[model samples]
Target: MVLTAPSPKIRRSATKVALVVGSVLNLINQGAAILGPADISWVHVALNFFVPFCVSSYSAARN
Candidate 1:
């Protein structure tokens, strides 16, 4: 038996969606830093940004 790969359109759409979602998460984290509680720790906020995950997604899309 053999399986066929998804078409280019579908693959691009999926990657775009993944990138957008990752961007939204990063944006939300940044916005929280600007408008959220003053007592929030810098370390915690930095972690919330999820930079590594977003970067990995971007790299994947680029390839």
Candidate 2:
């Protein structure tokens, strides 16, 4: 099946949710690196937020 882009409202909502959830997840998953001198995995950090945003937007679009 083909997929279309989600609406602006859905994208905005998904972004809000992603930011909140992703921040919590990042803090939990990489607190040491974030709060210390250790190197942080930038890719992993982006995915953590992006995955949630995609999931939210997809679900909204499906509905």
Q: Give RMSD to native, each candidate.
A: 8.6, 1.9
Cα lDDT of model 1 by residue, 1-63, tens digit: 012124454456555655666557556656665677645456745554445444544555555
Can you write out model 2's per-residue Cα lDDT over 1-63, one digit (the tens) per residue?
025445678879999999999999899888999999988989889988999998888888777
lDDT for 11 in candidate 2 is 79
TM-score of 2: 0.86
Error of 1 at 42 (Å): 16
What are the clash counts of all predictions, listed in order?
Answer: 0, 0
Prediction 2 global C-alpha lDDT: 0.86
Tell me how far the alpha carbon of residue 5 in candidate 2 is from the true structure, in angstroms, after superposition.
4.0
Per-model TM against the reference: 0.34, 0.86
